[model samples]
Target chain A: MIQVKELLAILIASSLVSNVVLSQFLGLCPFLGVSKKIKTAAGMGGAVVFVITLSSAVAGCIYQYLLVPMNMEYMQTIVFILVIAALVQFVEMFLKKFVDSLYKALGVYLPLITTNCAVLGVALTNVQKEYGILAGTVNGFATALGFCIAIIILAGIREKTEYNDFPEAVKGMPMVLITAGLMAIAFCGFAVLN
Target chain B: MSKSLERLYNGLVKENPTLVLMLGMCPTLAVTTSAYNGLGMGLTTTAVLAMSNMIISMLRKVIPDKIRIPSFIVIIATFVTLMQLLLQAYMPDLYKSLGIYIPLIVVNCIILGRAEAYAYKNPVIPSLFDGIGMGLGFTVSLTLIGIVREFIGGCSFFGNELGWFAPVGIFKMAPGAFFVLALLCAIQNKIKIEGAKKGKDVSKIQSGCNSDCANCAIDCEKRIDDIEITQEDIDSTAKINAAAIEKELAAKGGEK
Candidate 1:
C-alpha cells in the first residue's frame, strides 16, 4: 500500500533530516540538561518516545473523530496539550504502580515531558501535514528515535568531555552546545538525501 | 524602583526567559535561521506572553490551586491560537516561515513559566509588564543570535545581502545554531567571570522543569544558586565569572 511508503519516508525524514533535537530543536532542554550522563539521556529519551508515539496517535484520532465533527479546528492547541499532559501523567502513575525500576529511571522526567515542546510539536506537525493516524504515529516514533540517537551520542561525547580540560568560560553548557553543533553537522549529511 | 518596573527588569535581564533563565530553547534555536525569522517569532511570543500573563493574573484568584496548571495552559493556548490566526491573515509570509513554531509557542516554557511563577502571584499590571520585559529580553537575545547566524551562515542581515566574505553555509544550518549559541554563552560566561573578580554581589538565573530544577520555578522565589554553581564551587576564574553575570543581572534587576 502507498501508506507503507509514506510511512517509511516520514520515518526517515523525521529521524534523520528533520531530527527533533539536532535539526528542529524541539527537545533542547532535556538534550542539554539530561545529556550529562548516558543513562539519564537514554531514560529520558525512552519516556519521550513512549509519550510522543502515543500522543501523536491519540491526538490525530481526536482531531479526526472529535474536533473535525464539532467545527473545533481552532481548538487543536488546547486539546493536544491537554491530551499530552494527561497521557504523560497517566503513564507516570501507571509506571509507578507496575514498573518500579523503569519508573525510577524516568519518574521525575514524566512530569517534565508534559511541558516539553517536542511532544506538542509532533502532534501539531501531524495535523499540519494532514497525515493519517498511522503515518502520524510513525512520524512521532521516528522523531523520538531521532531524539534518542542524538541525545545518546551527545551523552557519550559529554562523558568524554569530563576528561578534557575545558577553558573556564567554556565549561558546563557552552561546551555541550559546541559538541552538539559538531554532531548536528554530522547529521547534516542526511539533508542531501532529503 | 516601582514594583511594575522591577518586574519588567526582572523579566528583561535578571530572569530573562532566553539568556538568563533559558526557559524556551525550542523556538530560540529552531527559528533563528535568519534575523527576520527570529524577530517574527520573538514578537509573536511577546504578544502571547504579555496577554496571557495579564489574563492569567486576572484569573489567578478564580482558578483553584489544584487545577492551576491546566487552567494556565488553556489560557496560554488560547492566546497563541489567536496570535496565529492574526498573523496568518495579516502577515502571511512571516506566518509561512514561522509555521509550526506559532503553535509550538503554546508550549513555550517562557509563557507558561511566567504565568505560573509570576502572574499567578502578582497583580495584573506587574505581571503584564513582566511579560513585556521577558518578551523583550527573549527578542533581543534571539535577534542577536539570528544576526550572528545570518551573517555567518547566510552572509546577510535581516534579508539584506552583504557583498563581502564567503558565507559559511554551516552557520545557517542546525549545527550553526548550536555553534553560535555556544559561542554566545561562552562569551557571556567570560563577562560573568570578569564581573565577579571586581568584588561585587551577584544573583543567578533558570530553564526546564525536569533537569534545571533550581532555576525553573513554578513560583517566583527560585533558589538559583542551588541549581547553578555557587561562589565556592568554581575556582577564582569561575567565581569571578559568576559575580560578573550576577552583577549584570542585578544591575538589570535594579535598572527599573
Candidate 2:
C-alpha cells in the first residue's frame, strides 16, 4: 500500500525539510560539542548513522513483535532505552573486535551515543508516527543523515571561524550558537519542499 | 550554610546545568516555545531528578562501579516513564505538547551527569538537594528564556497578547531558540568580563568544554588537568609535552 513516491517524500522531508538538529533540535549536544574538527565530526556522524539505523530496525522489530502483542506499549520508553544502551555496548564491542581501525576512530564517541537523545528521539518518533518496521528504519536513517549533514556543515564553519577576531562576549560558544541560528534560518528555507 | 544548602546553592548558581554548565540543551531549546511548556518540562525534569538522585544515592553502595552508568540510566528511565503516565492521565495538554520529549528525558545529560558527578558519591540528603537545586536552576533558566521568546515572538506574555508591535513570528519557530540562547550567553559573558576587570576572580565563567562536567560528550575531568598544566608552563613546550605524555601513560596504564 506504500508507494515509492511516498518513501522518497519521507526521506526528503525527514532529511532536509525537518532536519534533526536544525529544525527539530534533537541532537544539539553532539552537534555542538564534537564538531571542533571536520575529521572528528565526520567520524561521529558515521558512528551515529550506523548506530541509529541499526537500533531503529531492532527497536521496531521488538516493539512490533513483542510489546504490541503484550499490550505493554506504555513500557516502550524504558524498553527502548535499555535496548539502545545495550545496543551501543554491543556495537562498541563488535567494532573493537572485528574492525579495530573503526573502533579506534569511534571508541570515545560510542559511550556517549548512549546518552544522545537523537537515538531515543528517533525511536519514540517512529512509534508516534505509527510507521511500520521498514518505514521506521528508513525514517531513522534519514533523521540521522540529517544530523550528519548539519554537524558537518557546522564543523566546517567553526574550523573556518576559529581564529576570526570578535568581541570578548561573542568569542566562543555564543558565536557558535549565533551561527547555528543563522543556519537554522537557512534550513528553514527548505520548508518549501514540503 | 549546611552541606545540603551549599549543594543547593551550587546547583542554582555555581554550576547551573543549563546556562553555566550547558548540559541538557535539547529540552532547553525544544520545549521552551512558551512559558507554560518550559515550566511543565522543567518541573517534570525536577521531579525525575530529585527522586532519581535520592534513589541512586541510596543504591550507590550496592551498584558496581563498572555497571553504575547503566544502573543510573535504568533508575532515571523508570521515573521518566512514571512521570509520563501521570502527565498523560492528569495533564493531557502538556503531555501532548511535550510528546516525544517526555520519553527522551532518559538520555538527558543533566540527570545522568548529576548521577555521575554527585549522586553516586554523595549521601542521600545532599544528593536530593543537589537534584532539587539543579532542577530549580533549569526551571528558572527555561522559564526566563520562554518569557523572553514569548514576549518577543508572540507579542504576548504567557499566552496573553498585548497589542504591541506585530510579533516577529521567528521567535516562536526553531531558529528563535538559538538566537535567544546565543544572546543570553553573550550577556552572561559580558557580565563575566566586567567582573574580571573588577578583580572578582571570574575564572569560573567559562564556555564550552571548559566546564567542570561540561556536556556528557566531553570528559572535562581529563581536560581540566591538561588546562592546569598548560597554564602553569606556556613557555616550556618540551616540558609540558613530556608531562602530557606521562599523564597519558598514567591514564592508559590500567587499560589493555
Candidate 3:
C-alpha cells in the first residue's frame, strides 16, 4: 500500500534528490535553451509538466495494454515517440484554437516540445520502473513537478546572474552552467534522504 | 569539391551541432561520464545519422508534405531501433554503458534537425556527407566532454587503471557534466570573440546573432522619421495633440 507520506517523499525526492535535470541530466536542451528568462522558463516548465504527465500516463497505458499483451516490447521506443509527436501536435492545435495568447507565447517551443527528451524520458522511465497505472501516473506527475521546480529555480538564478559582473569568458552561458553546477552540488545533499 | 567540403567543415566548427546550435544536450551530458562511452555513443549516433540522412534524402520527393513530421519520425525511429538492436547484439559492454540513452536517440534534436533542415532539401550524396560531418562533429564534442569529465572525475583516461591523474569525483556525477559543459561553452564563446577581434570578417556568423541590431536600427530610424514630422508639417497634428493631452490628463487624474 502506498502511503500519503511515502508519496510526498517520492515527490520531494524526485524534485530535489534525483532531479531529472541536475541529477540524471535527461533534458538539458530546454534547461539551457528556455532558461534565459524566468517567464519563458515557467511557460516551458508548465508545458513540460503537462506533456510529461500526460504522455507518461498514455505511454504507460499503451505499454501495459497493447505492447505487453502482444509481447511487442521492442517497439516501445517508436510507439512512445509517435504518441508524443501526435500529442504535441494535438496540444498545439488545441492551444491555437482555444488559447491564442498561450499559443503566441509558446510559439516555436510548442513544436520544439516534440523533440524535448524529458517527455520521452519520463515515459520510458515509467516503463523501465514497471509501475502500475496509479504508480506510473503519480511518478510521472511528481517527476514533471520535479522538472518544473528545477527549471524554475535555475531560471530564477539565471535572471539574477545576468545582471552580475563576471569575466567575459564566463559571462553568458558559461556562468549559467557554473551556477547550475553549484545547484547540482547543492541538490546532491538530498541523496541522504533515500 | 569545395562545396561539399564547406558543408562538412561547417558542421564541425562554424555550425557545430552541440556547442553552437545547442542541439543534443540530453545524451551529450548523460553518456559523457567516460571517454569510452562517449565515443561509443557518438559513433553509434553518427552511423544512425548517416543512414537516416541518406534514406531521407533519397525519398524526400515521395514523402507527403502533410505527413512529413510523422514520416520523418518513423524513418528516424527505424534507424534508432536498428542501432539499438545492433549494439545489444554485438557491443554488449558499450551498450550497457550507454544504458537508456541509446534508445533515447530517437528524440535527439540533432538527428531530426539534420533530416529536416539538410536532407529534405539536398541531394543524396551531399546529404550523406552532411550527415557524416555533423555526426562526427557531435561525436567529437561528446567524446571531448567525456574525456575531460572522466579525467577529472575518475583520475583515469578511458579506464586506464593507472595512478597518474588526480580524480575529482564530481566529474563523474551530474554536476560534473554541467561544469564541463559550461567550461566548453565558455571556451567556445571565447574562440568566437577572439576570431571576431582578429578582424576575420565573420559577417556570415550573424545567423545566430541575438543582438537585435536590425530591430534597433529600424526603431531608431522610425524615431528620426517621427522627429522629422514637426507639428506644423503634420496634417493631423491638432487631432493627435488633443488625443495625447486628453490621455495624459486622464492618466494624471487616474493616478490622483
**Sort order, TM-score high to low:** 2, 1, 3
My TM-score estimates for the predictions, one after another, are: 0.87, 0.89, 0.83
lDDT of 3 by residue, A44-97 (tens): 778777777778888899999999999999999899989987888898899889
- Candidate 3, B186-255: lDDT as tens digits: 8777777888899875544421212221111112223333444665557587888889999999999999
Q: lDDT (0-100) at residue B117 of candidate 2?
A: 83
How far residue B125's Cα lies from its native spot in candidate 3, in Å, is: 1.8
Q: Candidate 2 regions off by >4 Å?
A: B209-215, B218-256
lDDT of 2 by residue, B1-256 (tens): 4998988888889988788876788898999999989999999999999999999999999999898877888899899999999999999999999888888888888888788888999999999999999999999988888998898899888889896899999999999999998987898799898998898977666554333232355443243336446756676977889899998998899684
DockQ of each: 0.47, 0.63, 0.47
lDDT of 2 by residue, A1-194 (tens): 45677778889999999999988888787788778778878888988888899999999999999999999998998899899888998999899899999898777677767757899889999999999898999999999999999999998999999999999899877899999999999999999998
TM-score of chain B of each: 0.78, 0.82, 0.76
Q: Fill in the DockQ of model 3.
A: 0.47
Candidate 1 chain B, run of 10 with poorest lDDT: B214-223
Identify the candidate with maximal TM-score. Answer: 2
lDDT-best of 1 and 2: 2
- Give the poorly placed runs of model 3, Cα more than 4 Å off: A3-9, A95-109, B1-10, B203-256
As a whole number from 0 to 100, the lDDT of residue A110 in candidate 3 is: 59
Q: Candidate 2 has what TM-score?
A: 0.89
Better of 1 and 2 by TM-score: 2
Candidate 3 docking classification: acceptable
